[model samples]
Every structure is written in C-alpha cells, then in structure tokens.
Target chain A: MELLRPDSAEAAAAALGNGSVALAGGTELVPLLRDGIVRAEKLVELRDVVPRGVDGTRIGAGTTLAELEVDPDIPQALREACSLAASPQLRSMSTLGGNLLQATRCWYWRLNFPCYLHGGDTCHAKAGQHREHAIFGNERCASAHPSDPAAALLALGARLRTTSREFSLVDLYRLPTDEERNVTALEPGEVILELDVPRPEASVYLKAMERRKWSFAIVGVAAARFADSIRLGLAGVAPIPWALSSVADLEQATPLLGTAYKVQIARALVRRAVEAVSAPAGA
Target chain B: MVVELTINGNAYELEAPVGRTLAEVLRLDLGLTGTKIACGEGHCGACTVQLDGVPVLSCITLVHTVGDREVTTIEGLREHPLVEAFVEADATQCGFCTPGQIVTASALLAANASPSDDEIRHAMAGNLCRCGTYPKIERAIHTVAGDGGGS
Candidate 1:
C-alpha cells in the first residue's frame, strides 16, 4: 500500500482496487486520525487532476474552498459561504470535495459509543436531543452534512464532474437510504474535476455561527435565483443541505431580505437537528 | 517526508515531519527569520504567507504537502510598496504583526486596487494587531491610491 496523489481520474480509479479511500483536503481527515476513527495505509493525492480555467470556473476536486472564494467572477453568496466555512487557516487547507464527504459530528459518534450511524442497530438522535440534527430529509443518522457551499451549489444548478458519473447537484440530491453507498455519488476512482455554475443574479448565505472562529455553521442559508424563481437550501440544519425547490411564487423570493420564511427554513432545520440529538449523552 | 519548495526566491529541500507546520519549516529550518511566529495555531494571521499568489495560514499548512509551491514570506516583501507605505505611516507599535499585516495588505491591494475603508478593514480582520495600530495601517493602504509618491 503506497500513498498516491494521482494526476487523473483514470489513475485514481485504477489505484483504488477495493480498500482504497479518497483523500481530499486533510482538514477533516486529520481530525479523524486524531480521534482514531479511520486510517489509510495508502494515500491518494488529487493535485494532478485539477480543473483548467475555461468559459466557466472548473474547480478541481483538490481546489481549496479558499481559492474559489477569491475569484472575482464567482457568485458573491457562494463566495461568502466559502469564506465563512471556517477560519482563514482552515479555508487555506480544506477542499470542496472533502467537505461533501466528511463523517458525522454527532456526540454519539464522537465519544466512540456506537449507534446505527457507524452500522449499528439503533439511532440515538431519533428520539433524543435531535434539535441540531435536521428537520428535512433526515434518516437513522441525523448528522448534518459538513459542506457549506453544497446548499448554494444546489440552488445555482451547478454541474458536478466525475470520472464515471456527472449530474446537476439537484438531481443528485435524493434522500439517502440504507442501501446508499456514500453521501456523495463519487466512486473510489472518481474525482470532482470542477463545479460549473451559471451566473447568479441574486444570492445570499446567512449563517448562525458560534462566537468562536472555527466552529461549524449553527444554521445557514444558500439561496440563489432561478427563472424569476428562487430555490433555498438549509445548511447546518440537516444531514445534507436541504433544498426547498418547490417555492411556487417567484415574486415572494426575498421577503424582508434577511428576515423571511426563506431564511426561516435554516432556523427551522436547526431546531429539528437539536431535537433529534438532545438525548442525555448515552442511550 | 522530504519536500522541496521555494520561499520568496530561494529554493530549499528539507525534511518535514508529518504535522510539522510550514511556519515551523520557514522559521526554524532555513532561517529566513523575518516571518515571525506569534500564534502557533491559525487564529492570528501573524504567521500568514502567500502560497502561489494567495494568502494562507502557514502554521496549519503541512510542510511536506507543499511540493514545489512558491511561498512568499515577509522577508520577500522588503522592497514592496506596501511595506514602504506601512513604514511611512508608522504602522508599527509593538511590531509583532507587521509581517502578517504587510503580507495581508499586499494581497488585498493586489485583488482590489481601490477598496473602500470598510473593505480594507474587512480584508485585514483575520490579521490582528495587539497594540491596535489599525488606524495607521488603514492610512498606509489609502496612501497607495493617490498620485503622490512621497513618504
């Protein structure tokens, strides 16, 4: 087993025989190492498979979230979300691909006390203090997924590039099931070459964050414009970014700008996530 | 891991342990010395540096992973106009955050040639000064906008 940062998807695919794990930004991975949750005998670096500058920005799987934040042409809302993902230090090291596939942060999982999230027989967040877990599209594990930009990407109708698969972020966002392989569609060999987003006319990402700098989003919004319509995604509110794509009235998009129902979804999601995980430490 | 990287304009090949920070590599190993290490963690931008033209926290960034990337430290900014302006405005009281401040300020000006006072404040928010010389730093940055080239 050798650590390999392949230059292409084909190379990564060939290297991932069976037990191989995809390594992106090590921000999350390093933490897992500290906690003794997972380990890789062989590492795969995705530096070579970077996206080229073209008509639209093709953010390579390895592109740090900070790099995208500085591009002048990127949508301001998305940029703001990326900027606020964590501290400047973390932003410097973390990548978008890694953010999407991070492990759960539930207290249950953190203490090494096992539940269904790690393939056990029960889910503690279901009837526990699950308030912070999520209200929309939650499952056995009420762990809110880690990516801050995912919500914005879904609303912007971004296209994800992979070695064997490709799709708009919306179609890819079906509710996860027990049979699901991973949170993302990425195979062992596949790499997120770039995320292609069309120009967004109006967008915003409002966040509920702890006073401490490196904390996760307490609750956040990744709302973007459509054809005279609007789609809102709630982050830090669910296991995945909850996209409210069925807003029928296009005119009522920004009710009171920062203080409206569109924004309320993020708050609502937070309340639910907190409810699910509110159990007293153990089962 | 044995990694080869360039700092400012000098090329260096050094053995950096896993979890050994780039900030450590720059200050301890090769002795460039100008880049100070105030906070070992990433909170204080005192250890900030530009990696491939973008400002990043050097403390948390691993040394081995850099792999030939160009790193610009405060030692590299000796003659940069931003440094001169900071000196002209006397933006140094304790002088601890000057390196990080100048490096961060240079990045800001490069991206936005004419930023508003609020924009400048926001850009430098990550880089903190213990003595609160922010007013002087702001004035120094503003000095770059006008046509006057005097100190």
Candidate 2:
C-alpha cells in the first residue's frame, strides 16, 4: 500500500529493482489489482518521467494511446491502430508502454480463474469457449495479445528503449510455455522509456472487430511498404503480434479452432493495406 | 499514502489507498456522485472525467496517479453549452450514459470548436449509448458546434 513517485526513470528503475512495479496510466494494472490477479505492495510512479523525451521518431512511454492517435509524426498505420484501440476514454488513459506490456485480456485470466497462466495445471481456454482467443502460437495457451497498438508498432519496425537496454518490438513478446507466465520478455526492473517508431514511406492498419468501434480485433493487420521492403504484423490470432516477413508467410499459419477463416480475412486485409499504402499519392 | 487532487478547481488532500481507482475515490470518498460508475473496467466510459482537460476513464485510473493534476467530473461541470445542447436535443434516453457522453463530448468540442459529423462520431465513439440515442447525441453535438458552443 505504498507508492513512490520517482522524479526520473533511473530512480523508477531503482525502485523497480527493489520489487516495486511501475504504474503509468493504470488502465491495466489497477484492474488486475482489483481482480486479485497480481499483488503489489510498492509501486514506482513514472508520471513525471514518462511524458518527457519525444522526437519525430521517438515517443515517450507516458504518451497516451489518444496522443499517439493524433501525433502527426507517427506513421499513418500506427496512428490508425491507436485510434482503433479501445474506446476514446480508455485511450486517453492508456499509455503506449502500458498497452505493450498489458496482460492478455482472456476472460478466464481476467476473472482470476485458475488457468495455465495463473499456475493452473491446464489452459482452460484450450478446451473452453475460445472463439475470441488465439488462433496461432497456441502451443500451451490460447489467449491472444490484446494490445492493438502492438501490431502496428511491430509492422512499423518500432524499437523499445528501456532504461537499460533496447530491443525490437517483435522481441518483446513470447508465447507461453509450460513453465513461464510472463508475456513480455522484459527483465524485471526495466522501465520502458520510449518507443522509436519509424515513419515509413507508406503504411496502413486494418482491424477486423466484432463491433464497428471499441472492440478487440478478431484479426488485425498492419502493413507497411517501403520502396524496397515490406513489413506486416498480425494480431488477435496469436499470443503475440506476428511480424511477418512477407504475405506468402500466411500460408505457414496454423489457426486454432475454426478461426482458419481468419487466415482468409488476414490475407485480404494484408492485400488491402499494402495496396492502400503502395498506391500513388494521388491515386 | 497522502495524495493531493485538484478537482473542480478545489484542492483537497486525502489519504488514497493503493490500488484504489479514481472512480471509487470520487464517489466514495469525495462524494462526487455525478461521475457514474457502471462498468468498473475501462470499457464502459461511464466513469469518464477530465484529467487536465483530456477525457480519461476514472474506473481504471488509480487515485495515486492523479498527483497534482486537475480532475473535472460531471458534478464540477458549470452548465456548459454542451449540457444545454444535450437537453435541447433530448439526447438522454436512459440517462445512465448521459453524464459520460456529455463529459466526453465537452472535451471534444473544447478541442475542436467546429467538429464535423465524422469527427464528432470518432471523438465520441468511446461513450456507448445502449439506449440507441447515438444519432440524437451526434445531433446535439452538431447543434453546439454550429453555435460555437456558446463561445
């Protein structure tokens, strides 16, 4: 029940090194605490440090999803992804760093049910109602990574800068195995300082949702095409956003449940996004 | 921990419990009943409030994170033109989501004095009206936008 408001990222990391979790935006952490999914006795408030340090390509960790939605410097694909994420109010409260680090939104996990992630013997979603769960990378778990912006970030080839180290957006996530519960590969005490989002020549983000607005993606695609290379990212069908090397890679995909239909949707989306971005400026 | 919050231009120092949501502190501790709490999660937008003029969901926002920033709840709203527009347009059907709708719409109008239909729709997409008064709600916002929101 103690909170430490650190003035700098280094101090925040120091507190985190001491076992205090970082709280920013609180869009994800507070709910977990309320639901008893995780317990934290001490917290390091990065409120002062998270909003600083932004450039044309670098976005501060404290930047809210709503801020990213309107930032002109961010690529169109990333902005579109942020805009499509959550509702407006939630976006205003959710930070880019928090969104990337937020836990899976699987109903079983959020409800505090004893599942595989919670140290239960088995993943209940594997056998239970998993229509909204993952379709790819369901080796041991079926929960999909819930962050919409993560897919766009991955497609943009974004790099995460922490207090101590830097890593690609793709390296941040890991599919759960039988032993580990942590989703992100970030080591303890590492505070995400900023995200380096490159402005591609052309990019587009498309999220297939159950609703027109404010629903998680059934299959999200972010495709960015440079003059020389192409980058594609997929969400809602995997434990992590799959940053594919090419469109043909979709053929290697193994879908969970009857959501193989998602592969067709994903293919169409990738084509649409690539076409939208690859089109001439006037065309 | 002692947390200082500036709500409705009034400064108050209160003992904030760790993991306590801003919605709980506002309604339970500070007695600001106007900010409704429907979905305790961040989805509903029923607990929308202005954190330094930006709309945020208090249901998921931790009270300790408020720090010294100003929070504007529906109770603190001072009869703005957006409220009047809602009344004129009969935007409230069930009245449960009206507070959040008005609060969110007010932020939108404040940022863009003349938001178009598409802009209005995108800006207010977060606040759900299960009563299906979205058309009416957008109309109310348009009414205020055309009038410059009473300046």
In terms of lDDT, the best-performing candidate is 2
lDDT of 2 by residue, B29-148 (tens): 999988999988888778899989989889888888887679999877768877888888888988998889888989998999888877887888888888998888888988888854
Q: What is the DockQ of each candidate?
A: 0.19, 0.80
Using TM-score as the measure, the top candidate is 2
The whole-model C-alpha lDDT of candidate 2 against the native structure comes to: 0.84
TM-score of each: 0.71, 0.94
Q: What DockQ class does candidate 2 belong to? A: medium
Cα lDDT of all candidates, in order?
A: 0.67, 0.84
* B31 Cα displacement, candidate 2 (Å): 2.0
**Residues A38-71, candidate 2, lDDT per residue (tens digit)?**
6788978887877553587999988888888888
Considering just the first chain, candidate 1 attains a TM-score of: 0.80
Estimate, for each residue in A1-283, the C-alpha lDDT of model 1 and write its tens digit: 3457777767876776465655565666644654566666665666556554334555565667777677677876678778777756467677876666665566676656566656675657665655456544554556666567887676567788777777787655444567762455565566666677777656766667654344566667666664455666666655566676553322333322222343365545434433332343553
